[model samples]
Target: MVMLGDILAAARGSAGALERWLAHADPQLAQDTACAAKSVGLGIAGYARMAVADFSRFANEEDWATLVSSLRDSSDPGSTCLAAMVHWRLSAVGCRAHSIPQEAGAKDE
Candidate 1:
């Protein structure tokens, strides 16, 4: 069985690496984690989509912690599953910034 460390390592390497792990992992394990990730991802996506409509709501406190509490409190691979879920959610919502931050004195193009 894939350990939490394995999942975290893959996630740290790249989202693709995690995807590959999911793809090649045991069907039950992959399906369980993926399903959990998808549920969390879509919930987060709802919040993000809402925040896009109302920036103020961006700061809204959600019970997101509870959402992943199960994954976190689970046995081995629990945190790893949470990590993957978070990654998937962020990617799904385009939360990863591809551009570098500009310096204080940087001129705008």
Candidate 2:
């Protein structure tokens, strides 16, 4: 996993990789929001978030849309999820970001 190619292989495609990484990272983060918030900026999660953000150019409309919605979800401070979400937006800032005008699984408007 030292090479860029190795890292690329672990991520699969350009999307859904965050969930996979998180599964390996702190699977409990999804279940423990309080723990996640407290863990933010104090662990690899921060670097992981930054890594996700680095994928902006690789993100599709669907990817961007999910990221935005996740950011708005403050139900639990959005901790670990927020890390990846923020990165996704930042990475997209310089590019022609894509997104769904409607919610996920909703009919397109």
Candidate 3:
């Protein structure tokens, strides 16, 4: 099981490595890698937003779409839903800062 922070860190690191690899790749691979990196960064930022009670009030459909797109590409619906639920819960709490216990268990990456 991986905590959100750990997952975000791994994603960020992978994105960095992928970006470097993209610099020497074919056009298609470069595009794919860039997209992956962007997705990972988005996920990390989304998690941070949730942590800071900023994600719920930040109702940008475009951002949601971006997240959904990334989730689809990554084939990780559970992670997507977890991220979405984090924002949803924040919204439920009126975006107030509070401590929420981890539900069920840590997500597998």
* Candidate 2 lDDT, 1-109, residue by residue in tens: 1333444444454425545555565566433422332344323334444445555456678876776676466443334344455345334433223331122243432
Off by over 4 Å in 2: 1-25, 28-50, 76-109
User: What is the per-residue lDDT of model 1 for residues 1-109, given as tens digits with 9 covering 90 to 100?
Assistant: 5665555555655666655554564445455445544544533223223322332222223424543555566565544454444433333332224211122343435
- For model 3, residues 15-101, the per-residue Cα lDDT tens digits are 453234334433454443334334444433344334334454554687567656766666545444445544444333322234232
lDDT of each: 0.42, 0.44, 0.44
Candidate 1 residue pairs in backbone clash: none
As for TM-score, the candidate ahead, 2 or 3, is: 2
Output the TM-score of candidate 2: 0.29
What residue runs in model 1 are displaced by over 4 Å at the alpha carbon? 1-7, 42-109
Lowest lDDT 10-residue stretch of candidate 1:
94-103
For each candidate in turn, the TM-score is 0.30, 0.29, 0.26
